[model samples]
Target: MLKFKTMLILLVTMSIYSGNAVASPTSQVVKDRSYYEERGDIVWEVPTQKKTIAFTFDDGPDRKQTPKILEVLDQYQAKATFFVVGERVERFPEIVKLVLSKGHEVGNHSFYHPSFQNISKEKAVNEIGKTQQAILKATGHTAVLFRPPGGSYDQNIINVSKQNNLQLILWSWHQDTKDWRAPGVQRIANKVLKNVRNGDIILMHDYVYNSSQTSEALKIILPELKKQGYSFVTVSQLLSQKDNPNTHIKVTQ
Candidate 1:
């Protein structure tokens, strides 16, 4: 009986030590990269009750319109995401850095703004890969979000994005400002204000053929939204609020 009791105690002690050795703090638990990679593709708008929206601009690093839009956002202390064309980024690297410096998020739009649905898988991959390289080179930051040119995407785009570890971001149809059409500034602002809602992703452009109207519309949209108690955030920040309610969004600078 004595020997059996000693053996039982030793087994209990060993079990305790083994448990201690494998124990990990909740905060220290690391998820596999695939865990995040699997979440990639197709984030249109986060579903949340919070009155937060994300404004996403595409095809930019425009010397004129980008600066003007940034100024308007700065005046309202709002944050946004810029889905920049890699070729344009290379041409205007300074504007890329300026976008980042002003506390906005930058995402890869594509190298040449090609429609993904019409491209081969290899071409899609190359487009995404080259833009990823360009963004890193210009900003020293790897972009994890990609918005296909013209918001057109397919399974090929999703596969390429997963292979490159990028999330495919799209905008809500209702919130598209259509400023690229150069609709009068008031009309552009009205399109957004009239259709805006919680958890919306507003789409606008900075380097459309003529985006002066976009810059003008922002002057009205930003202040009006602020007055309506809507907070503008980056795409990642808006998604984070929905995915991890406990997570606080630290505005990227």
Candidate 2:
């Protein structure tokens, strides 16, 4: 029993250490993008007013969660951005329609959501290109914004996005739901509510094991934000400026 207890303690320590190591990679990637690399024409985050936030859903247009999330937004009269994957959009075209019809914006999350930093330039182009075309065909609108898979990017990827005339978007803040672990709905909701601020961009997955939690959290978050004088807007609306024509531009082209 003594030996077993000692081994268990060691295992716990190792698990914590491993998690820190895994998280470090994302931080490193962000730092690399922020300074060491020139991101060309890709604007990582949108500038917005105080007390405003953009809620963006990534990897979605999902049949199950996307509709539920839309219903919640409808109840609050809130707007959001859905960064839909190309393959998924091809599979669930109706979800894209619902997103647009309901007043939400759709952006490109890529055709397959591959890692831009690791993939070749040709593959990177296809990743964004196919999705851009799919979004255009399905919704009859062109996607001007993109978020790279896993937030991994480099100079070549930025150049490709610029060539495609895309604005590369990233998050200002993240609510790490870890919903895949099936963390309870309340826990996810509280985490997001606690961390959100003005000019914040919250990231949540539309298709995942914990998608239900994401939907539930948004219901609580929207009302709470409203009470605090915050208005939910799609990414473009949140990032737009009166002086810049692109601010109010939609996908129609």
How high is the lDDT of residue 29 in model 1?
35
Residues 1-253 of candidate 1 have per-residue lDDT tens digits of: 9998896555333421121111111112323323322454466667777889999998898999899999989999899999999999999999999999998999999999875535777888889899999999998999989987765555666678888888888777567676776778899899889977777888899887865888788889889988999999999998877845433222111
TM-score of each: 0.79, 0.78
Worst 10 residues of 1 by lDDT: 16-25
TM-score of 2: 0.78
Model 2: colliding residue pairs: none
User: Best TM-score goes to which candidate?
Assistant: 1
State the lDDT of candidate 2 residue by residue for 55-103, as single tens digits: 7888887899999989999999888888899999999999999999999
Error of 2 at 209 (Å): 3.2
Q: After the best TM-score superposition of candidate 1, give how far the Cα of residue 87 lies from its true spot, in angstroms.
A: 0.4
> Which candidate number has the best lDDT?
1
Give the C-alpha miss distance for residue 40 in model 1, angstroms: 6.3
